[model samples]
Target: MAKKPKTAITPVRSDNYPEWYQQVIKAADLAENSSVRGCMVIKPWGYGIWENIRTHFDAIIKKRGVQNAYFPLLIPKSYLEKEAEHVDGFAKECAVVTHHRLEDDGAGGLKPAGELAEPFVIRPTSETIIGESFSNWVQSYRDLPLKINQWANVMRWEMRPRLFLRTSEFLWQEGHTVHATAECAATEASEMLEIYANFAENMLALPVIMGEKTPDERFPGAKHTYTIEAMMQDGKALQAGTSHDLGQNFAIASDIKFSNQDGHVVHAHTTSWGISTRLIGGIIMAHGDDDGMIVPPKVAAQQVVIIPAVHDEADREAIMEKCLGLKLVLETISFDNIMISAVIDDRDEVTSTKSWNWIKKGIPVRVEIGKREIEGNQVFFKRRDESPREKHIMPEDEFLGSIADILLSIQNNLLERAKSYRAQKMKKIDSLDEIFNYFKSEDAGFANIPHSLWDEGLSEKMKTDFSVSPRCLPIIDGELSDRLIIARSY
Candidate 1:
């Protein structure tokens, strides 16, 4: 019994987040590493969560006229060098395959052959290689809007790799498209970044600030880079995803030219947007509590866990029978297969204590079936929070409706709460000294100020002194409708 109890318990999240991270990840059965350094073996449970994200985002992308496709994993060294800036940006992080053949030495081990040809580089991003295909597929104005998205794994060899955040290899969907004109490509880039923001907010239950990346932060070959940034519990920023407008950069380099509507050959506009498995990190950091992982309702693999507390054998039989029909309506982002367990404490202690058990597991909602509610044809619902007491009972018709509404409410509240948190932490500053001062404090976010004018002189001086640059300079000039956020980013 002691052994059983030891295996069942994980640490509370209130005490420590890093320790809590280790515990919850193990308790939730997400994933862990194998023999490979900086790579993870995502358990089925973790992958199920990713599948939920992909299904939701893929549906949105499909509606926007992007079709799914597959691209090669390995790019020849020469192809990676097509766009010079891109080559320079990604060259240091690339993994190269040197030799394929191995010889059995006189000793018991096998040795790699000395003979080798040109090395192939594992792709950090598919822009250049995808550009090669675009050059061929795009010819006339008619083939101009060639939009395709691919779900694949990319290897970005990192010296220090965390599980999902900075893994050596990660899974993502990269969208590559070529348009007839630069304006359409720019629009496409912004449109996708908005989609990413919406999905982050509404579906993943994360709050984000949408902004443009400065020249220094721009994707290697991109003319302009747009990004959605999210804050974690630690007050650090995570660049959740990015969309780049290539502005004839890759098209020019790869010769992806199309005859225009005016009957003149011109470079096609190109754009690429990518969102990766690292989003799971954003979701975890944004909404997760000390309890475990507070999965946003839309992406929860098991939304509601039915924990039926039993008393007499009569109570057990009645609860088991009630749970029988529960499987029929189980198809939902929130609904898991109906579960009926008779497991009970040996001392016949109060079954109400099991509510804490479910809370510790981070189940979004727990439908409690006790004698009173079961007999009354109602079940009680419990939420995890410090706010107040909350419980409800509903008839069969209202069961699905209530759960759906509750999930949506949770999603919205999380976004609002995070937004409020960030606004309170941010202090708009006016000088370079403020930037240095803010970094020294416990408040882990931004310090430098935003300016309306693109003071080439001030920005240039600021860059040299602070080693920091403007995060976003608005393209649609305004009374600075949104002030630029200055920060040192990842």
Candidate 2:
């Protein structure tokens, strides 16, 4: 028998997937559990990735005529009560604040005091409060379309907290739009869903299935909900993003009525869409391997890292100078419309240690500068998408000239690999028995069945038996289809 090879992350993904995921986050130095229960403190590297996601998506939305805005983090209890269904949907997760201040107890401890007339709830979602603002701002046909987006943090009391996947408080961007006509609002919802799908595929290198949620799965008070679902390497599905067609439910609840061109007062049609930091979790599960994360080049925090390999004291100064020069040259080059970000790992450590650190960090390109390569006027590098042992040698000038193309190739390769994996894992099944049998195995993937087969009874049975649910009714070529995708999801 052969001995198993060592890996950077222990309990390889094949042996223990759930533990492997937690280990990956630690190995990558992405985030850690915070002092507050159910919350996490995102480290610099993780936050850098999020900053890139926000910057790119913000530009995309601005080009679509969406204006950025801010809203209060807390909402009055009465405000949520105006929309009954919305309140009911999030009731279990609401974190309410009853007292305004704390007073000293006799035993030198503090206790709640200054009770208020009405309690406030930290927002699980901002629909009601934003709806109130929209009501006061719109009173005529001239103010028909109000499109606003806010980048902020939201709290939802979570029972099972997973670092980036689900936490009590997380950062997100929520977009709210009010249109004069139902048709316009519906179009806005669909278009936003398309935007999310495109961002996931092109920027994140995550392939997803664009679809409409079943009625039971729709957002609270929303007539329709559209989503982009991605499958993780562990054979579970993740709802990457969602857009809601709210129709007139929220407008009616908040009295957002406007005078139309025909001199009739009517409630406005509204839509809301959002994507959160959970996307970071999706990226990890979709592209991470047993060794570590494989971040797509487009969103990698540091695209290129140059490590100086110094074997002797005499070579240290020369190698460090070469590495620093390479970093400056790499920064001048542009990739995916942004200047490349390169760093020098010139720490007082061994070359292999520095290389392994960047590999675990998932830097897209790793370049090594040693006496041999410097004297030969050559560059030696390895790509994260390939095996760790794989290496390539090229002329220094050629490497600099082709760096953009190389990054683009890495992005495209990751996307194609995810698409191929999804195709292999998905199955088309016609009967419920077959679906149940398929899920009996430990590594069952997605099952595609007829939408007509989904029902309240079947939903309960699946939840009770196999913990499966309908992911979505896939949209085919700009139209909703009857085929449904069901899977065990995160």
Candidate 3:
């Protein structure tokens, strides 16, 4: 049997990975299962992290000439059928709306009423409906290279939902762009993939492998699909984000045609890219430890949490006053272009309770101001990146002065740590026997397998034999190589 843990969370990562993940989310109070099956309700703390992610990525895309817009939630059934491949891809997972209203059934329970002439689909993705808009909006060559993005929720009926990773309903930002030429569309897709990689590495402090998906795994109707895949603590791979170069497939299907400078009409080349709330799961699995999550400093909802240590009633006011003052000062500071956000814990709980709460929630820095520290004009601080038992005492002003640099250090350190972890788990396999032997351990991570040895049924065989999948084929030295990364995935 696995040993019990000291903290509120139990069944450590090595003991039970799936349960450990759910426990981490529970201890952090990030999100919870909703009344509806395959759905989740994101709590304030979890939403705050998502908000940070949206804000940063929004700024980045806007700088690249992408405009944010809203798309319809319900799409006509015929619209999806315009693209044969797209419809086939999402047909089984779509939620169809057969009736528009509900009425009281004769037997007491309410029942669907008023069958519509044509069915509507709760959008599993906005591609089809958004394509209709693009068809209507683009009429001339001047409208070429139109870039649009939408932040919305989508529903894809999942049989086995797992919180943020594969919920039926989840929030995401999808970028759709049109170009005059196929080359431009391909470039746009590649650029968006790079943007996602930067966000994963710099903001989330989660290292990822970015590459092109194989034909069997490419997005429906896409010429090529680029993805950023991150390795989890359990040695499984998670597809963090995807960008698809759709060529002219979607444009032609939706009739998005435009007049060219040469006095000819042609279908526009298009691209679509997205990153979803699944990234929250990626963050949890990438940096979380036995103690709990270690939120990257760059995107932490609360960078610094001040817990006053007041044993005597008289000392409460002074310590709290100091904490409030520190909060105000910390708010005014900036690090790596991110303004520091801090909070004072004035709750009626013990200092240990407050500290552990924030620790599980993954606050980057924790400070405790006590009678002795306040009197001595010093601050006791601990970094989430270090051991929970380790603490440092520094003059109050010095601590405040170095806070920004300290946070930057923590962010870099987390990325470095993840990089090292991935490096240790990565191996190069030249033979099929070696690949089979490597994955036999069950914790087998990533293997760089040569495509020359790939057979007609290798992918299916791998899945059946070891539950592993080919992650991606990376481009090296400006050439697409036969080498691919194969691993088990979530």
TM-score of each: 0.85, 0.98, 0.98
Tens-place lDDT per residue, model 3, 278-394, is 999999999998888888988888899999888999988898899999999999999999999998888989999899998898889999999988889999999999988899999
TM-score of 3: 0.98
1-490 in candidate 2: lDDT tens per residue?
A: 8664588888788899989889889889899999999999999888888999999999999999899999999899999999888988888998999999999988899999899899999999999999999999999979968899999999999999998899999999999999999999999999999999999999999999999999888898999999999999878999999999999999999999999999999999999999999999999999988788888888888899999898888998888888989999999999879789998888888888888888888889999999988899889999999989999999999999999999999999999989888988899999978988999987889999998898899889888898998899999888999899999998
- Taken over the whole model, the C-alpha lDDT of each candidate is 0.73, 0.92, 0.91
Which runs of model 1 end up more than 4 angstroms from their true locations? 1-19, 113-116, 311-315, 330-361, 385-401, 452-470, 474-482, 488-490
Ranking by lDDT: 2, 3, 1
Q: Write the per-residue lDDT of candidate 1 for residues 127-199, one digit (tens) a residue.
A: 8788888898888999868899999999998998776778899999999999998889988998888888888
